[model samples]
Target chain A: MAYSNAYAPSAPELPESFVEQQLDGENRYHYAYQYQPTQQFSSSSVMFPPETHPDIVKSFESADRDRSGFLDESELRQALSFSGYEGISDRTIRFLMFIYKNPGDSLRLGPKEYVELWNCLAQWRSIFDRYDRDRSGKMNSTALRDAFFHLDYMLPTSVLQLMISQFDDGTGKNVELCFDSFLECGMIVKGLTEKFKEKDPGYTSYATLSYDVFMSMIIPFIVSYD
Target chain B: MAYSNAYAPSAPELPESFVEQQLDGENRYHYAYQYQPTQQFSSSSVMFPPETHPDIVKSFESADRDRSGFLDESELRQALSFSGYEGISDRTIRFLMFIYKNPGDSLRLGPKEYVELWNCLAQWRSIFDRYDRDRSGKMNSTALRDAFFHLDYMLPTSVLQLMISQFDDGTGKNVELCFDSFLECGMIVKGLTEKFKEKDPGYTSYATLSYDVFMSMIIPFIVSYD
Candidate 1:
């Protein structure tokens, strides 16, 4: 139930200037720093990069119950939950680890990586809020298309229809996606495209895969999201 | 149970010449026409292209229970099972429909498209058999890699590891995949790749997608496979 209510859409709408700043690219980070959350964190001993928000640091320190200065899979899961990312899948966590974890370390996220992850999540959070125009905590197919178009994905209409149908709550005639589902969707696209690029370095839009290798690469993303 | 036994690996290995001919590209179809199944079909009123295999024709006729020339989703599903493709997911069926159904039609497959589908499956079946050298009804990570490599998809070890871990039966130390699972894996890779190519026609390997569009495109493949 906590996870269900994780994105209850209570935050005030972002001002028009904030949207313009986000479009200006470099200024987006400036706005993220300027934007303040209603919730406050208690002061902590942990020293992070000056750019790292205190809220993020508090969330991380609280989740790192062992205080190992590193967050393993379980700790990372807890950290995400504390940050309002509920029901985070192991695959998504691994994907986050794949992106931000230290090169030599495969399973743990150091403080720097944790900070980076928080920033990335914040950026995505802004994108989600921008498109959920009704502040209903969900977006219909058209809005979903506009949101992705704003991101430059240019997906086919059929593909868009398939997505809404999959996540449709069934109570309504229109397909609607909540914040958590939107995050999962974003990560899968980002993750798979990155993986595909490894083989298609030439950008040929064509890559051949053996049955098993293909299965192995994709099954995690597919199964975890389900 | 029949689906489980679908790829029992009882067929004799392809002769060296057949492998060489397959590598020669155009000669592969000639060989397909020449290769004969032991099972025989009785004389039938239905006429087919000279190139079409009688076994394929027989399978199609049997699955077309209503004597309709075209196969709807359920009929197509039954036809695939009759052709040794069992446990086929609805998503995959929709995918097949997407590929083979007529331009004006969204659901049914005419005989021509059905034949093309059969040929495509046959090609995939050979590919599966070729990589399954041990014929234990499964392939380990290395074999999976080689199989994909043969198909020109050079995926990273991390991706392959993730995939195997996903479908791993847990009863064994090593991950192994059966024919049906292999089919599902290949379809996901092929399906997602084709979808990605639509947006990345320039083959830039960098296509932007909105969270929702990305989710819609991928969720189908992911959920159905699971």
Candidate 2:
């Protein structure tokens, strides 16, 4: 029930008219943030809006059950996962910590440091929870595949399979994902497709970057900062 | 007053500590969506969540002054502009209409189509408003320039000038942007930077892309869809 309420509106309920259009094969509905296979969105230079940090702090501190004044990685990960990043991975979570940490405190996150990371994670959670239909605390592989397609990605099944495997919760079942792992997968696909779109701006809807570019640009961000 | 209240919490309110960090030349905090000039985020294949659409409809219909059963371009533009996209242009509004319109009704947008377009514009507005610190309905050149930089772009002033010009509202004053114009600018900066990162994924805070990508991938998206 907890997850269900969180995901109650996952498929942003469109009016019947639009749904009819979709059923009639008129896939004309396009979301502004809908990932375009061949287009890149401009990045904004402003930092997170100042007012949202408190709610994040609230959430972070609330998740800090022991009141340690800092959230250990696992606690932070658990907090984020339950809050909506159901499929994010340990690796991606670490990278997030790496990118958002305070100067002296590398491993544990203070409230100030945690707020910054929380802002981004919150956005990711909003987006992630939107597509997490079953609310089973994980996006099953089939659902994961659909999520990508909805974002206009056409990844190969093998790649999708491997991605799910990386975040498999060791349940002996290989198809579902938690928030951290899901975020990791989304980031990679968005990152690569964004690149391909840049190179093949002719509306190819697909692009091929050099291996060098792939290695140099796409790989480092995801591989872990440690 | 309503709009102001709505916007009051738009920026994540950081505690004093983070503010101190920002003031003290410690720009250590970073957004997850910060467009890295280099590096790729793996793409997650998921569609936009459906629940968020109704709130969009409520906003859109509330903005419909004449109650024409649809939001004309200007009404739509005004709604979105004041809502958060302070410097959005007529061209981008039209393009939004084009991308979100029903097949037969190209000129006027009903709540259904408007909700989809509103979703993207709402996002643009969220990012745009955060940078409109004064709430002046415009971001001056310095602010606009900083907005791009914050998104990790290092655009040549010439390119920035051209971009500002294209979306200029023709007020004879060229130093600032309304929501329409600002949204147009943000799109280009984010689009190109996203691509560059895919190629130059090193730790460079800035990267460069060809003019061709700008003209193709981004330019088309913001131009009039009509």
Candidate 3:
């Protein structure tokens, strides 16, 4: 009675599911800042109750409850299980915590933060594409360092410092991440900063270097002052 | 020092990475699996490790960390991240979690599960060679149900109970899972019970329905339970 209306197609249903040979089977999919389609798929298609795919659109749609485009987390949490990840699992959501809970504040992913996230994600695909050097279609360690190095990231100073220190462990053959490691390190730092700092203080160019490098590079002037 | 010993080549080694199909451009393979050949590949016809694609071998070798042959959670966690999952982010990892965790237990996918996954994958070759009944290269609900009803699944009571209950919801009037879901669900269940159920549930012909009937009549049962 309930989902019947929610899931059943209001539009003219096709004789079967879309015949895109390229679609992963059953309209199944996941959410990610990814550059490729997955391998999992099936031949089965549907002709009715056509709520299908990427699941993100579905989640957003469900959350918009009244058919409005905008969303709040409460509404999102209720209707969208998203196979188990709800809003808490969304990248835009995490980004909000970073934005609103400015180190001094404890705000959640507010509307303001949400807008910034949308802006970033809209362009993140192209950003990720540019750094994928091997052209394998993904941004791994090298790709990550390149993005951070060439582009402007709005990260905090402390996080930036950690980036430089953690990656440059003495031996400097592979100074910057290739892509894979970049994502790993970036995410780890993001997680820690969120839990401890409570907000993003912001990032610096020197954030790419460590304390020792900072001492040799920036301290010459600052320490002299101290 | 550790990696040095492994590099001694007994034969020619493939290039550190895959030879790009230059004319084609690797749009599809940007995030496909990477293989790196650590040891000098003795001349082989398969991967051309000693001469090329050694990196592909290397990637697989890295993923199979323990040399366990089949990838486990840790292995999959690490391996897939290289492809773009960013270490199974909550967004991307949701679908996998659903399949592996199902109703109970953290699943350890093995060769059987792997093969089924492959079977369900979309191919450019033939959609209807045999799998599709309507020449659509895709399966309609009836065809899907018929196959399911007939499988020799020694289903757990909970799973069976779920299926029967779903029958009551009536999604099965004339519907079936696309090829991929069908394989994933059936194969995982079969693999679990037959290969890893621990208790070794025996197959019972009596309880098993025909694939035709399952697609036709029992799919609603599955929907309700799910």
Using TM-score as the measure, which candidate wins?
1
TM-scores for all predictions = 0.47, 0.32, 0.24
Local accuracy of candidate 1 as per-residue lDDT tens digits, B109-202: 7666677777767776788888999788777778877776665555456555555554644222576777656655666555555445445545
Model 3, residue A6: C-alpha shift (Å)? 40
Give the per-residue Cα lDDT of candidate 3 at A157: 32
Better of 1 and 3 by lDDT: 1
| Candidate 2, superposed: residue stretches over 4 Å from native | A1-48, A59-89, A99-116, A127-131, A168-174, A205-211, A222-226, B1-226
- Who is ahead in TM-score, 1 or 2? 1
Label model 2 with its docking quality class: incorrect
Ranking by TM-score: 1, 2, 3
Clashes of 2: 72
Query: Candidate 3 residues B106-221, lDDT tens each?
Result: 23333323222222322211232344666654455445433433343223333332232222212223333333344334333332222111111232211222111111111111
TM-score of chain A of each: 0.63, 0.52, 0.32
Residue-level lDDT of model 3, residues A24-141, one tens digit each, is 1111112221213233221322111222243444444545555544444455444334424333333333333332222222222322233333333334444555677667654544
User: Candidate 1 vs candidate 2: which has greater lDDT?
Assistant: 1
Worst 10 residues of 3 chain B by lDDT: B217-226
